[model samples]
Target chain A: MVETFGRHIRQSLGQLSYAAGFQLFLFKETFNFLGKRRIGLRVLILQILFTGVEALSIISLLSLGIGAVIIIQGAQLPDFLLGEQLYRILIIVIARELGPLLTAFVIIARSGSAITTELGNMVVSHEMEAYLSVGIHPVSQLGVPRLIGMSISMFLLTVYSNVFGLLGSLTVSSIITRVRLADHLSALFANFYLVDIVASIAKSFVFGIIIAATSVYYGFSVSGAITEVPVKTIRSIGVSIVLCVIADGIIILLTMLVTA
Target chain B: MIDVPIVLDDVTIRFDGRAALDGLSLEFQRGKSTAVIGSSGSGKSLVLKCAAGLIFPEEGDVLFEGRSIATMGEREYQQMQARTGFHFQDAALWANKSLGENLSLPLLAADPDLSDYALHGKVAESFASVKLELDPSLRPAAISMGQQKMVSFLRATISRPEILFLDDSLSFMDHAGSRQLMARIEEFKDAGATIIIATHNREFSGRLADRVVVLSDGRMVASGPYQEVMSSQDPALLPVLRDLV
Candidate 1:
């Protein structure tokens, strides 16, 4: 039993190693092809449209709600400290941490699973073999676009969350607090540093890689059976969520270390 | 251009501890037609797939000319792929792409510089070759099995590949459709594309095969010039060759 567990762990590690290498190669090939092939660029555009643009509604709504709650709760602080605490809390919660994490969760629930299912179905239907026989490399053609698209989407969505999130708290603060408008605006700008934006970008990029690579790898892992499609899809979704969460924690810890 | 003949040296493939192809070796000559015939589990399709570099063998190597395909460079492999075409037993058309895109993909891969107008012209020309009038926009699921097979045939031949592998390609075709594909196959042969097919149709194989390989239980039982193999008196080859002989 122990041996079996060890073997499973070994297999999982090997799979992850192979997937990381494949994604790196895919990234190079996708960009190389992007310059020469219109077809690849078109696929990248469609991926961004489906993964980023279509997801804006839920992202905006969630950010708005979270930002408002933080403001209303911060208002309970002693009057003199309320103004400064509000901006610092908002920047920390909305910009540095929650914004990237929540956006990643949304992508894991949405685009990651969809990518896995779509590729898994393609594998089941022999479309991948068809691609190979026809001289098209599946990883270069299908994978790179999705990787670049998800990373691009993740970066954009995280920024969008920051914008909508701050706007949300600002609007709520204007209504509830008697702090002068000029002071509030200045405090908000002062509390927000360049490192926060950089942190968001770093967190989003790492999360995007984890999700896209995990999904595409599982999708192609569906071998020879229609039943395997759903199995792989579930595995893809589960692994993506776990990895994203772990990555979010690590990025937070690293950034904290760096700034300290 | 792809080099020929394709040689399989003592190839073996196993699935779930059972050998699908066991120590089978065959060589396909340039500009010639070879047919692989066998019973249900006899590995005829396995031979074609191995030859096409789709499946690697456990025991030995498949070589294009003298170079092992197992270790071939990417540029060279891509060249072989562009120069070769395979028709699957189940049609295996892309589910998401339209029939037009299915045909266009192979053509585009072969020559990415082809203009869109020229690409459509070529697609239309191939559709005309088969006399298939279905919309190019129809997905594989939207078409009948026979129509799917025809589109598959068109896609395989769209680029006029120098090496062609067809696996039970006529399974879903009717009399007229089969005739259309056979005529096209003849044109491919006439143009010097090496033709390798796995089929149960003795008449089709007998008519086109310059040589025949009979497989039984994942091993080659008989292989020779078409007429020589057909007339052999060996008892071991008799059962597999009964109908063909």
Candidate 2:
């Protein structure tokens, strides 16, 4: 048993060494990537296309649906509770948690899983080896664009979702009750802080990095034929969600503690 | 005449206390064809990996065109990669890409300067030479094994590499198919490309290699011209030679 455990540890160390080496290669690639002024601009453009424009519609729809649902549900509450505090629920749920989580889920479903499968295919086909052979680092060439795009996507989508959700809440509230657009905006802006906005941005960035990094890690670590792509992707999504949620919780707690 | 195309000097590769290659020394001359034959786990593939700079040796250096690849930087390594083509046993086609995309990858990676039309023309020409009609839109899964092999072969040559390595690339082919592929390889060799094929195919090795290297248990058992290696009096090579005949 001891021998077996030792063997496992040794093998794991070797594997870790391989992964660490690749990561260092990725870091070097990233440094080189940042040094290239034109590629950065191109990457920024691609990021906007990937993370901004691509996210607009879904964010709009999801936020609208959630806003409508919240208003409908809040309507069922006793009049006393719904009268003054209804907007607060919309602000807290949609802006603080639901918007970001939903945006992350969208990315996972649409882009995150796709990145894993794509990088996985690259790994299995030895394209990574080919890239290395040609003096191009795979992480820099592949990972940086993905990391940048994903992080940007998460941030943009969250902001978009929150904005649209707020609009949705106002629209729904106006139709169902006596709340005006002016009142809704007044309440929302009154409660909003630079710190809160920064928190949202920071959370989105962390979520993006986690999603991109975990997906790529799992994708590259996948050990099998082409058929295993979906399996790896599913695993990546599962891990990303768990990590994102934990990270979100920790960040929120940390922010609260610091503020208090 | 071109010095030595590649030089492996006293290279040793050990895995978990087991020697995959034990202090092996060899040379591949410029524009020549050599075949490495051995049974499973005899470290034939390891030699190719070492040559391609995929695996580092515990000892010794691999010199490509006189410069050691052991300490070669990213720029020099990339330059070396441009100068070599490699095909694996399973073809290793990028599954996510269409055949045309796969063929264009190395060229784009190596040169990044060629016009799209010129790249397309080069790709078409390579496919033409391989005698495989690669559909511009067909993914790797949509192709047959033979077609995949052909695509892989074309992809290897897209960069017009000076040296080519094939590790059991023809293992899955039928005899006639193998012959045709070997003939294509010979054509590449005749065009002044150094070719090294690591295989268990005795007959293919006999017909294709100018020099045949016999590796057994991580050591070179025999090395010489095909006729001589195949007719060696060494007891260890007797069975391998008999298998060839």
Could you estimate the TM-score for every candidate?
0.91, 0.81
Write down the worst ten-residue block by lDDT for model 1 chain B: B236-245
Per-model DockQ against the true two-chain complex: 0.65, 0.31
Looking at model 1, how many pairs of residues clash? 0
The sequence of per-residue lDDT tens digits that candidate 2 reaches over residues A49-82 is 8666877887899889888888777778677224
Q: A231, model 2: CA deviation in Å?
A: 7.4
lDDT of 1 by residue, B149-181 (tens): 899988988888888999998898889988888
**How close to the true structure is residue B25 of candidate 1, measured as C-alpha lDDT?**
84
Which has the greatest DockQ? 1
RMSD in Å for all candidates: 2.8, 4.3
Clashing pairs in 1: none
**TM-score, A chain, model 2:** 0.86
Which segments of candidate 2 are over 4 A away from where they belong? A1-21, A34-89, A130-136, A181-183, A223-239, A242-260, B9-23, B57-61, B65-70, B172-180, B242-245
